[model samples]
Target: MDPLYDRLARELRECIVTGVYGAGERLPGVRTLSRTRGVSVATVLAAYRRLEDDVLIEARPRSGYYVRNRPTKAIPAPARSAPAAQPSPVTGQELVLSLVKASNDPAVVQFGAAVPDPSFLPVRTVERALARAARQHRNRAAAYAFPPGLPELRRQIARRMSAYGCATGADDVVITNGCQEALVLALRAVTRPGDVVAIESPTFYGLLQALDSLQLEALEIPTDPVDGLSLEALQLALERWPVRACIATPNFSNPLGYCMSESRKRRLLTLLGARGVPLIEDDIYGDLGFGPRRPPPCLALSEGTGAEVLYCASFSKTLSPGLRVGWLVPGHHQARVEYLKYVLNMASPTVPQLALADVLHSGGYERHLRTVRSDYARAVGRMIEAVTRHFPAGTRITQPAGGFVVWVELAPQVDSLRLAQLARAEGVSIAPGPIFSATQKYRNFMRLSCACPWHSDVETALARLGTLTANLSIG
Candidate 1:
């Protein structure tokens, strides 16, 4: 390499190593960088040219230069002569762990977590129920938790499922650590590595995480923001792929909050059942619909299918997320799910499950959800209106029937990751759109949580977000 070329390559490589250029990130144009750094355009071009030749950067026509794909830094090897520990069992699950951790950083505003407002939850009522359970099981609190969760709690879950038109008995229900674990158990019970599972596009990240851990391939079906998955697209996927299972959120799906129409629900179940595709319905947010009446769950809608829908739900969303109480109504796969649930973790927390049962039996949980639904509805309206008024023209937002999330579309020039960083500096947390995309296509979109108190400060925060959005360069 020429001397200048060598120097430029070294500098650019160092910048990339230090995250100045960053992974999957496009760098400023040569002319712009030259102007900022007071270097000759030729020198800047030479640097980029050398970097490209070295496979350290790539040029996209009309899109400027981007850092090339580089392997992540390997862990430093143990001291050269040290005894090598046996390599940890490799499961090919690193991607899932990385994505899940990225979502948990406290610095971010947490539009990513499908959590309801704590203020809206009946915390006091739950506390009281806990108190009652403590008194009732004072001596028992020292004992090991009941396997598969408390029997009465399972019975309570069964009663609620009855409202959805599924007359499932408590014996068929297996309580797990949370909805996530319930999903993992169902997946483990029905699927093995290399099995293709169908999922809605932009589906719940947790579900994706579970699938990734299982070493399963997810075939995404195009989903409508307002109507859940497209039946036609799903039919095509089913016909084209040998899918072992289908995992979906038919009511108030996370991120998008799309509810499948009852007619579509019936049709989808019929179609999947006909094709022998086992459906895993995540109804965690079912009871939190903003409207007065709740849509019957997909499991309820799949009543006559003789056991096709493996329904899973939890109070983690509507109640205390920390409680980590959830269940799986396995329908046709009941025995398998129950056995897997036992093998995986054995059971959920005994005290919390018992307390939740008491809370449900006493009707406080219903009242709490009613309050959450009303407040969340108002917050959703306020957010949608704010996005419309504050965002630039052509911005589109979802009007979900329930839940406190709104998906906003921005002009293509606005990269949400950059915007989220800017928003965080202003004491606001937001979920960037890329986190929800498997293919990372929604750089200009974001998901906002309306689960916070709609107070003056939050209102100002919303306006500030709008201002940031409006001032974004569309270059």
Candidate 2:
């Protein structure tokens, strides 16, 4: 039997989907809904919350809940990727740099950077926390914090990890500059230069940059657009190549934005455990899930199995990126990672850590997450709708379960690089797919960020991009 809240939510959702409740139409007040439906106010609220999480409705303080204007149609998600089955050198640094530069330009309509817009963030809350930290911990802020960061922050992280089933304590966490640094530490701790690392085909460009920096080769593995990394292909790659370590973003991967199932995560951990290979799991975007609960990390799945899953994550995606706060649990290799972190850079900034700790301790971070998650979910839906309306026939895209980026597979003749160049000239920035691959594949693919609010500017940019892609495809 379904819970009362679930039943209520389902009925309401059906009404909205069927157009019974028109877009922007206000829902009944909590008291009215409870009275009419013979349910408690809590149940009604829960139902409304579920709708908000689903990006179907929004709440306005002092007003009421209103149905969001969602697109009537959406594009079909792209098919599973079939990357080449050989190791390749990473060489997309220049292209990545250009994309980064263009993404940062204030004049451009940014669909390139996988960063949440400030409007969607808790800016005032963060500022208040920073000011309070500076005022209260002036001396601590003045000193350099070594390797393992603030005890309070680590405790907060560990406490949060328990929600995802990771039985970690403060001692297991090592703070770094960001998830990038944490990834570097994990990679350095596990493998040496010239070693081969297995990664998702349409992986994060940052991972490729890390591999390039360390002079490591990447063995591209086939990844599903919806299911995440393909275990069978990875197994084949493991059998064929002398892979040192496996790196993946199991929960809400960049570009692809697929979250591995719990069972698959367990299988992946077991596979790596049997091979004596460490799996570096990046969960930077794990908190941005639009579901009722956060997904479990691979480390959580590997718990008690003795699997060496180095869990890397950060508050950058959820909290404040400018703070550059990230942490990792390196399992058996904790000491080695700590030393590497010390050698790489004595420690992360003290003020930001303390400030973030205060924010987490205040119990406001969770509330902020709820708000941001809803915003991101809505933004992603809007982006999908825009693409469906604008893109030419045969264009395919990824309907991500979470995260703020969408991957689009254009016609074979369409060159995303040329499209990006054209988009930039028109004051728009986009991330070309070639940057996400080590072998420069995905030439007709592109990643679009849904981090910003929907507006005319974004709509215009997508239309322009569609036109450019159509022209390229025709030529």
**Residue 106's C-alpha lDDT in candidate 1?**
46
- List ranges where model 1 is wrong by over 4 Å: 1-112
- Model 2 CA lDDT for position 416: 90
- The total number of steric clashes, by the backbone 3 Å criterion, in model 1 comes to 1
lDDT of 2 by residue, 1-475 (tens): 3469977987897798678999989999999999998999999999998787666789999998999876666677888888889888897668777777775678899999887788788888999999999999999999988988899999999999987799899999999999999999999999999999999988999999999999999999999988889999999999999999999998999989888999998888888888878899999999988787899988888865556889899988888888899999998798998899989889999999999999998888988886677668768877887788799988899988898999999999999999989999999999998999998889999999998766668888899999999999999
The best candidate by TM-score is 2
Q: Model 1: per-residue lDDT, tens digit, 1-475?
A: 1256446656677698679978779988888988887778888888887566445578999999998765353212111111111111122223334333544564444443456657767787888888888889887655646455678888888898887688789887888888999899888878899888887766666776687678887776677777777778778777777889988888988777877889999988998989988899898889878666889988777768543888888888788887898888776677777667667666566788879999889887776775567556656766765565556666777778787787777777888878877887776777776665444546787788877655556667777888888778454
lDDT of each: 0.73, 0.88
* RMSD in angstroms between candidate 2 and the native structure over all alpha carbons: 5.9
